[model samples]
Target: MGRMGDATRTVPCDAVAVSSIIETTGLVMEFPSTRALDGLDLRVSPGVTGLVGANGAGKTTLISLALGLLKPTSGGISVLGLDPSADGPQLRAMIGYGPERNVFPDDMVAYDYVRHFAQIRGLPRDEARSRASDSLYLVGLGEERFRALGTMSTGQRQRVKLAQAIAADPRLIVLDEPTDGLDPVQRDEMLAIIVDVNRKFGIDVMLSSHVLEEVERICDNVIALDAGRLVAQGSLDELAGALGGVDVEIVEVADRRDSIDLVAQRLVAGGWTVARRDPGLTVTGENDEEVFDAVVRAVADSGARIGRLGRRRRTLDDVFTNERGDSSDRPSTARTGGTE
Candidate 1:
């Protein structure tokens, strides 16, 4: 099989115009037992966007609404300038979807499965066959294209799902938990393919995943949801800002504890918040320039050799934790109702 990234064959698909790939206002979805979405507003542009949330945070419901599978309880949504409810068929024709579940038929070969979907998407029989072959090779399944899906591993099955999604050459692709059941190496491969799909084909992508680190790795923008509400939406750099502090690592010394204590005392006197960490200290102040000066003064006053000093970059996890106001180390699993 050809490496996914090495495939130079271009599939036939038109690039979408630059516009709001997805936009929604006051969108809500209510179930019999509870509300899944609550007055959510989102304006996502064309690119790779990460749809992030805890379980039951309306990520799945929102994707359904975008695809026109389910009508909303209130408000409006526009995908590719077409209303999903009014133009469901046309909208779906332009969008490719890879669902989270293993919904493949066990008896079908990979090529036949992808070709079937391509034909269903209105491709001619001959074009469907060609697209299927190219897509399978693009996903590193060229050698396995004739193998039955039931015989494939979980990672290989995921690649098959991706191949079928792109075989029709849709303008946009939406993936849910695409890397759910893969090992570290497999996960990396899948992520590279997703990125290549967008980079090479110009297909806009809305990736829904619970793994924040994976989202941070590839997504250009992030939409973070909490309990069916929009908690945060911005570029990764905008959301994960600098920690507003300097991390200091002190060189080992005979009186290490005493030196750390002295530095802490000096920083506190300088109106800086000092928190002790193993082998280091975290100092934060209102002004970055002043904070830097305070840190240098503290280290010098303590007569301690400085090992390292630098600002720390906040991660998506930190943003999610702070936004949710949940201090638990475990990832968020807050649910509203029904399957997420």
Candidate 2:
């Protein structure tokens, strides 16, 4: 069954969290075959914010536009109180970026790369060298600081990119797919570094990823997208709770989901809709004794075997799929407004 009552009563899973940093309006970017980004709008705050989407969904495009690397055909994007289109260099100087792809001077040692960045930031030669070493250590590069970057592994190369970005001590860091190629241990190490970058250095980070679970674990808030459009944006709990509530359906069937059509009809009588039929059907809304009893009577009357029946807690992934998937046949559960 879909839900017991109106899919409007939201269950509070946790407290709320909010922060505001980057903001956009009527954001649009176009290309030859497809509109890379539509009339998109987003609000990104400080702390560790997760920017998530599938490939070609405009996650990369949005970051490029926001950082001044690319301009929107029409729309406004701002970072750290500056417009990237006009003050690209100035804004970038105050913001650091680590791209999804690895780019570095293969011939240069890690020390030289970071030292060069520190020098470009106007530090004296000696201080630049010191800062470079400090950055190397911060990312767990010890004696390998003098090793040529081209000779390094993918993980090591990424660390170099991070080191150079921080050498300038920018207040804001934008990481595009930061954990792209690392294994479990390496990924965890990188995650730890990212957290330390925010907590210890007091820098605000905007990280983009397709790894939904990673985003949930590390982010304070999320701006999720699908096919280049913003579908849902907020703290994890807030977004998931908006799905209202979730419940598992128990049907009497040697095959639990076989006779859902009959049960669906009975559920419709009680103002419930059948959301899905899998291990069991998923119904929306709450703990309704009446609905449970109704389901029992229907199943017993139909001579269906009584299988497992329970409620499943909604998760961030569930909320993401439900919101970003097709909406033509579905009803929205109320939401706050966003910029055009």
Candidate 3:
């Protein structure tokens, strides 16, 4: 197979032309017994955004509506400045999507599969062939382009899915669980390709995944949903900084419990809100510097040495836990139709 040339490196025109990639207003999708999305209002800027939610949180439903696969029960949605329901064909021509499931023809070779989708997107036969080769190369499957998908490993098959999604040079791509089923190294490689797709091609990306760490790693913004409702949306820094505090760990001593208790008492006396965490305590204050000073004073007064003390930077996992509470036991009522 021929390698991708400079002529085939064209980027989508709409990548820079559009400001908001996706927008929804009062969107609702109801099934027979459960409502998938409830009055969701969202506006996503042009960047790599992570769509986060638990099982049956209407993530799949929202993606379907955005891609014009499913009409909303009520309200409106816009993609690339076009109404998805009204201009689905035109809109889809400018966008690409990779669903969570493995839906591939066993007998089809990688190049043919991607080229077929490129032609379906209206590319000429020659351009489609060039694009298919280029996309496979982009996903690190160039050498395997002629291999039957059935003969490929799970990681290679996933790369083929990604190659097809980008074959037409779409302005935006929606990926659900792009890193699923891959081992650590494969997952890292897939994530790097995703970042390259957005950074190098300027294609906006909306990634939906159960792995918050991967989301945190690759996304510029995040949209969190819960029980079919919009819970949070913002940049990683914004969401993490909202829950700022200090974590203080006491030096382990024969009487470590007593030392921790002493420090906690002193901090509480200093008007700090203290919470017990294993091996130490978490303290919050109106001012961070003041909190740090108080912690120092408390340790000094208690005569307990400090093991570790630092401002706690909250992770995406922490943000999710704090926002969603203990909803782990809540049964999923929303119908995802085989997607999460």
Candidate 4:
């Protein structure tokens, strides 16, 4: 993982190499019946970081706590170098929030709606109007800025929410399920806009979503939560490494189960971990040679004709699935860290 000199450091595991833009230590949030967050400790870097988990994974509650909209039962959090609990206004001014729900007023014009929030957040009237217009354009809503929000499509409304979140030019924008209700095409568009918001505008983003593909596409780092505990946190590469080292998959020819079995047996004898999966066998080793040599020797010895053999990088979906198994085990309330 690449390291930046900023306060935000990339965390592969428990050891902190540098400070983070957002840091939480022993953060806990308790509801009447269950805990929304339990001794949660997380560190986030400045780039786009995807917060991913199953439904009710405390993703929303975590964002709310970071925004200072909800108070944690205990622990500390720092966002943009300031404590969210202590310096709420100051910290919030630097952080824009887009909730999962559509909170926009149907009657208001898009540009006016965005400008009003900017003004409320301390921007002068004229400045708010200017920034709102600019942000709307940035989010590809320039043509629809004058239109009523209620008349727009779901994708358009989502864009409007994003525009308003960035209207005040906050240092960090927290997006909760930004692609929640869009179709595939609209989802792609929204993700593109998110990429531009971070890359072109040089703004930082914390995107929380259950769509693993979206996160995989746009985020440089990911923080996965399960049962209010950090399932994993690090750059995408780091997380992949943590879950499992590099992986290689080999598929045998049609109706060649015996070939794969022999390959697995050979690999295991070579002191390499191998997993039997549908259509193929997954082999893992310390290096490419170790994995490749085993596969080669096994295939040659067993006379197993290969259909496809190559290294495959694990996706966020794989990591999430492997880390948190069985959707039935995930709770609806913070009890199982599924929802909060």
Each model's lDDT comes to: 0.85, 0.73, 0.83, 0.78
Residues 129-229, model 1: lDDT tens digits: 99999999999999999999999998999999999999999999999888878877788898999999999988888999877888888888889887899
The regions of model 1 sitting more than 4 angstroms off are 1-18, 248-273, 276-280, 284-310, 328-340
- Candidate number achieving the greatest lDDT relative to the actual structure: 1
Off by over 4 Å in 2: 1-19, 241-313, 326-340
Better of 2 and 3 by lDDT: 3
lDDT of 2 by residue, 1-340 (tens): 2123433322111111224568889899987788888888888877888887766778899889988878889988877777888877556667778888877878989999889987765466888899899999999897799999889988888788888877777777889988777776677788889989998987888888877777776788888877778877887666644343334455445655446666656666667655766645655536556556666665665556546665445555665667756543221222223111
lDDT of each residue in 1-340, candidate 4, tens digit only: 2222334333212221334668899999999987888898889997899998877778998999899889889998877777777878667767778888989788899999999999866677899999999999988888889999889887888899899998887778899988877877778888999988889877789998876767777898899888788888999777653433324345555666678788778888888888877767777777866677678788878777766667756766566667777555432211211111
Supply candidate 2's per-residue lDDT for 293: 66
Candidate with better lDDT, 1 vs 3? 1
Q: Which candidate number has the best TM-score?
A: 3
TM-score of 2: 0.71
Q: In angstroms, how far off is 125's CA in candidate 1? A: 1.7
Q: Give the TM-score of candidate 1.
A: 0.82
Global Cα RMSD, each model: 7.3, 13.2, 6.3, 8.5
- In angstroms, give how far residue 23 of model 2 lies from its true place: 1.0
Please report how far candidate 1 places residue 178 from its true position, in Å: 0.5
TM-score ranking from best to worst? 3, 1, 4, 2
